[model samples]
Target: MRKVILLFAVSMALSAGVRSAEELSVDLMQSIEDTNKSLSSNIALSNKQAATADAKELTQMFAQVETFFDHKGDAKNAVDLARQSKELSTDIVGFVAVNNFESATTAATTLSRTCRTCHTFYKKE
Candidate 1:
């Protein structure tokens, strides 16, 4: 309950700065990539605090992706993948909170794979 409220507060605060304009997908993707690396490293180190922070940020970023895909309305698969990524991010936060580094690592791996799968379909080569 406390974590959920904190997450909501953090998410709202983070998104507040960008109220002037929605982030371009490219910019958002770059942010996701950078945050993902931090998340993976922190999970490997069993740094719960850092991992949780990164995961929370990722969860928010993937939510943005989900909204982008849903609004585009051309790729249901992308929307699904985005949602899966978001859930995995949240899972990582929970796993790390409990000192379950192995499970957190697994969730992070799946999250990376999910992003790559979406890129295979949507990214221009």
Candidate 2:
């Protein structure tokens, strides 16, 4: 009876663990989707000959990403990457606002790199 109870307890714990992980993964994917939506919107605005609009969208997206990181738990590397990406996005927004396309492009490239790095590690197939 004791052995059966022990086994049942262990199984329950394992089930709960799996549920928690699944929840976390779902939340993370949602965060990524939100970030991607912002990026896409900004890119479209940029291509529409509206640099100011693009910069505003990018800034908002970066803010959402930061908020996502703030709510995350046990994702230290991801949080760090998000922070770095936010800085790059901020730089891009600033440069674009100033009509400095060259510098904005460079900052955007860096931001892309940060996204790729984070995805490669955290986004599993």
Highest TM-score against the true fold, candidate: 1
Tens digits of per-residue lDDT, candidate 1, 76-111, equal: 998999999999999999999899999999889888
Which whole-number lDDT from 0 to 100 does residue 107 have in model 2?
Answer: 69
- The reply for model 2, stretches above 4 Å from the true place, is 1-49
Q: Please state the error at residue 116 of candidate 2 in Å.
A: 0.6
Report every candidate's CA lDDT: 0.89, 0.64
Candidate 1, poorest ten consecutive residues by summed lDDT: 17-26
Candidate 2 per-residue lDDT over residues 55-115, each given as its tens digit:
4555665566556656666677877887777677667667766666677666666776777
Instruction: Report how far off residue 110 is in candidate 2 (Å).
Output: 0.7
Query: What's the TM for model 2?
Result: 0.58
Per-model TM-score, in order, reads: 0.80, 0.58
